[model samples]
Target: MDQNSAVWLLLVTALVLANLPFIMVNRLFLMIKVESKSFIVNMIEFLTYFGITGIFAYLLEKKVMGHVAPQGWEFYTIVFFMFMIFAFPGFIYRYNLRNYLHKA
Candidate 1:
């Protein structure tokens, strides 16, 4: 694949993978018929999954990138904002009506 297509594939992959826990947790809750939960709880679970994956990537950075330097608070600040962006789909899934349209 071309570089642009490859990068887009990676982004789509990341977003799907990053959102899986939120999806699965909500699915499991639905399976058991749980009602009324906080959005932050789902977001936190999603972030926990993303954070674990980040830790694994950091550990492998030496093999992948040759050198993985410690990042500053600014880097984390950027990542925190990025995580919010990443979580947008899940927020919409939970709050928006488009999900119902798919089933109709």
Candidate 2:
């Protein structure tokens, strides 16, 4: 694929994977079948996705641009917010949206 296509693919993949934790909790997705919806488990899963996505982005930058730039705390803060934004849809689906769709 072309460079632009590859970059877009990576971004979309990151967004989906990062949201998987929220979406898959309580068997909402077929691959996961966790019965407990504990806050600790969700928090850990979110953090794990954050770290994995960050590393993936870093490596993609290094490969595509041929160098990795130094980042500050502000950079991390922004990325964290972006990850949260990416997870927003899943959050709504699991909480508000799902409740509205119940058969009862």
Candidate 3:
């Protein structure tokens, strides 16, 4: 795939993955149904998604460049914040919009 395509793919993947935890609270990894998800559970799921996105990005980078590039703490910190930003929509929906969703 081209660099542009790969970049977009990574971005979309990260966005979707980041939101999955908030969107699907009934089950973990589509299994192990729980009555309710606590904040700690959501955080664990969020971090899990982050790790998965990181792996996907690493593979994409390796495929595009034929090697993995070394990154510093700054790079990781920025990426984590970006993932947090992408999760905003889901967070809002889960916390704010979900109540209205059922009432309407």
Candidate 4:
């Protein structure tokens, strides 16, 4: 794939995966079902998705460019924040909006 397509793929993947922990089934990793999930559990799952997204991005970048670029702490910091922002809608819906739903 080309660099531009790879970049868009990574962004889209990050956006969807970032929300999975908050918005999907209580099951972890879409397996290992739980009766309920706590904040900490959700966070752990969220971080797992983040790691998955990172690996996916790495592979795509490597494939597109034939090498992986070195990244500094600042790059990671910004990317982390971008992931968090991508998750904002799901976070709000799960924590803030869900309670308001299912009410008469």
lDDT per residue, candidate 3, 65-86, as tens digits?
A: 8999799999999999999999
Off by over 4 Å in 4: none
Where model 3 places Cα greater than 4 Å from the true spot, the runs are: none
Q: Write candidate 2's Cα lDDT for 65-102 as tens digits.
A: 78899999999999898888888898788767877988
Assess each prediction's global lDDT (C-alpha) against the native.
0.62, 0.78, 0.92, 0.87
Query: What's the distance in Å from true for residue 100, model 1?
Result: 5.7
**lDDT for residue 24 in candidate 2, whole number 0-100:** 81
TM-score of each: 0.62, 0.82, 0.93, 0.93
Model 3 TM-score relative to the real fold: 0.93
Query: Judged by lDDT against the true structure, how good is candidate 3?
Result: 0.92
Better of 2 and 3 by TM-score: 3
Single out the weakest 10-residue window by summed lDDT for candidate 3.
23-32
Residue 93: error of model 3 in Å?
0.6
Model 4 pairs in collision: none
**Collision pairs in model 1:** none
* lDDT tens digits, residue span 7-104, model 1: 46545655765666455543532354345445676666676766765665565555455678889999888766776677677667666644686778
